[model samples]
Target: MSLPRQLLLGAAALSLAGFAQADIAIEMHAVDKSGVGKTIGKVVASQSRYGVVFTPMLKGLSPGLHGFHVHTNPSCEPAEKEGKVVPALGAGGHYDPESAGRHGFPWGDGHLGDLPALFVNDGGTADSPVLAPRLKLPDLEGRALMIHAGGDNYSDNPKPLGGGGSRVACGVVKSAPK
Candidate 1:
């Protein structure tokens, strides 16, 4: 085989391999008061050295600010207060990749998982372009994302998003099948 032809074939194989590895899907679910689980959205999370890029399919949501976070626990089971499963808070706290000092959105001092607010449209849908740092596919095995009733200020003061009042919805993240 010619040297140029061999090089071309090698590049083609590498491109295909990269494409196959780049695609990753994570299962997401929303838990409600009846202890019933609903499919709220699916986050196609891609891993990079920087963090995880999540592209969510948003629909059937109320228009307004929604608090989105990575909780510590992975349990979708109903919380004691209500039958609903609070995955965000339920998971525990924010995803602190660096364990750095506390800070707000657009800032990197706080938890690596701390993301910007999720804005919904009147049509009851939201599309998020957010990143969760220090997050690998393995870390999300049992973790889930919770949507709050109110918006997240990303601060602890006035008691808006920081308060974490209600668990509007939640979705458990599972590895996509191969």
Candidate 2:
């Protein structure tokens, strides 16, 4: 084969190999409640350069904004029988990849789990986008993504993420199909 032709072929092969090596698969699941917790909806997420993009499958949700965050632990335990949460702020706190030392989205120094507000429709269904830095496709392999009751202001005024209330729903992330 000619030298020029061989070089071109090698370059093409290398390009294809690089494209094939890109990480693009992400998995999502609907976390089922164990006890007092309310099973609200499901979430489907995928990884992107910005972060982990999320698409929530909401049902029976109340109209208006809801607080969403990436909890530290991967457990989706239900609220206690006394109507109190198992861990005061179980699900751990916000997912902090860089540990920027703050809460709320757009802060740039906020937790990776501090996502944008989730607005539900009149029909009680919410379909929105969220980004979590703590999740890098690899870290999300066994972690959990949770949705809270109230709306998030993305600030710590009345509270971070609008002091979004209780843990309404939860989901565990998995590796996407090959």
Candidate 3:
């Protein structure tokens, strides 16, 4: 092979190889009072040397703003919440294992699990990649992806938890099949 041809082939090979290393898939499912069952969409998380990119294609959602965050647990069943029952209560609070207990902007070093609010269109579909610079793809493992019933102000003033309301949908983060 010619030197120039060989160089071009080598470059192409390296570029394709780079994609293989970034195949981290995280899937989300719909969870009501039943449980974490129906898969609504999947987030393909690609982590570069500097950060992770979460590309999501979510569907079958209500038309409105939903509070999206990473919770500490993997279960999506309804559980006890201050002596009352709630949807996806088993997922626990936002993945604030660090115990920060604050909210407002994912870039503001707020709650560790804080993420950009998810906006669903009137047709009940959302296709946007929400960014979370504070987290890596691997950090989602064993955790849960939650979609709240209401919107998030990213602040705690009139209500707690940004008034996101109850957990409406959830998905457990796990490694893709080999």
Candidate 4:
């Protein structure tokens, strides 16, 4: 084969490999005391040079900043809290395998699940893509993706868990079969 032709084929193969390696779509939904509700949309997680990039294609959210994170459990069912059912409490706390026990920036030494705050437009849609520089595609496997009712200040001082309030929407991250 010609040298130029071989180089082009190699580049194309690399691009295809990248696509094959990046595939993890979590179907998000509205959650409440009852249970998981209507499907909001989906969030596609893919690999990037920096880290994992979560591209959200969500709607029907309160127009404002919503706290987003990866929770420890793989379930999004409501869990009982203080004798009352809580939304998405089954997802447990943020994915903190390292036991950081704190909420901070995506790149901070706190909870590895601490992600960037999601912004929903005035129309109640969230299409922005947030990058978790400290995460990889594998790190998100068998976890829960949560959208909080409020914003995340990336701190635990003024409020716990960045004062994200209740869990509004959630989705489980299931890995594609090999």
Candidate 5:
């Protein structure tokens, strides 16, 4: 093969390889007790030397602490749960592949999908960045990112799953651009 042609092909291959490790982003949308389907914000996730960094650019929130986690499924459609139709039930439980059935802090040994709480400003928007040391870029693919209506206590004692009542917003984790 010609030297110039060989060098060009090699560079192209390297570019393609970078795509496989590209960061992931989730386009968060609005949802309510009524059902699901509304675009509101976005959550971009990327891996760093420390861990997975979650940068959320959200708007139209309730202006408080919202529980955020990675759910098992990719669907954000409303579905019935325990005989009642809950918002984003189609996304399934917290992304607990091990069936841990436990809820705790993101740093603890519980549901692997647990993440840091999201804080929204008085203007009903959140643009802060949070990190999860236990998460990786590939761990979020095909999963659903859900934001609860209330704050997360990071415990299962009085209420389940940090007492973050109701799934209010969600987005599906998809591949990022190269």
Candidate 6:
């Protein structure tokens, strides 16, 4: 019944309400030059104290670290790049609305869509959650989530996009239905 206690409760309630409004679930799938394949699982994206947390429930991926990112478009279909078909190329490049034009850490001054690498266990499942401190729920809309075929070094040296190689999996982040 104390005033301080009431203020604390009020703040907690407000935080929860804000988070509830910003949550989204993106369905992930295997992708290749053929296009999006069977459903792998889903990623539950939510707001946390530090930033947005992406908890994936994916499976059937190769073991080791894989590059993860938010691409500029919201489609997972394959597209023609040069003379070759690139899977998930319809998703465009990494979300760099500011024109950073380079790859960096999740909290660095580069692509706003840069995210921490995802780790796949030996059993071929990616259940570990990763954080993108520079991202929020609103930044995800009208974009696509991409998983690369290789690990990310978080640098542009000697390779582009952290040498993540090909796009192995993808998911589109659609707006919440009314």
**Where does model 6 exceed 4 Å of error?**
1-22, 176-178
Arrange candidates by TM-score, highest first: which order? 4, 6, 5, 3, 1, 2
Question: Which window of ten consecutive residues has the lowest lDDT sum in model 5?
Answer: 13-22
Candidate 5, which segments miss by more than 4 Å at Cα? Answer: 1-22, 176-178
Q: What's the CA error at residue 68 for candidate 6, in Å?
A: 0.1
lDDT of candidate model 2 versus the reference: 0.58
User: Ten-residue segment with the worst summed lDDT in candidate 1?
Assistant: 3-12
- Cα error of candidate 2 at position 86, Å: 4.4
Residues 64-165, candidate 3: write the lDDT tens digits: 988988888877788765777777888888888677878767666678888777778898887655556577776777888888889998888799888998
Question: TM-score of predicted model 5?
Answer: 0.83
lDDT of 3 at 97: 62
TM-score of each: 0.67, 0.66, 0.79, 0.86, 0.83, 0.86
At residue 79, give the lDDT of candidate 5. Answer: 84
* Residue 90 shift from truth in candidate 1, angstroms: 4.7
Residue 149 shift from truth in candidate 4, angstroms: 0.5
Deviation (Å) of 79 in candidate 1: 1.6
Name the regions of candidate 2 deviating beyond 4 angstroms.
1-40, 79-90, 131-135, 175-178
Candidate 2 lands at a TM-score of: 0.66
lDDT of candidate 5 over 60-151, digit per residue (tens): 98999989999999888888767888888888989887777898777678898988788899999887666666777778888899999999
Off by over 4 Å in 4: 1-22, 176-178
| Backbone collisions counted per model | 5, 5, 1, 0, 0, 0
TM-score of 1: 0.67
Worst 10 residues of 2 by lDDT: 19-28
The RMSD of every model to the true structure, in order and in angstroms, is 10.4, 11.6, 9.5, 8.7, 11.4, 7.8
lDDT of 2 by residue, 66-153 (tens): 7777677666655454675443244566677777667655325677677666768899887654445445566655556766777877
Residues 26-102, model 4: lDDT tens digits:
99999999999999999988776666777789999999988899999999999898999999999999999999989
lDDT of 1 by residue, 14-96 (tens): 33344323445545565555553667766565554545555557777789877777665665555553553443344565655
| RMSD in Å for model 6 | 7.8
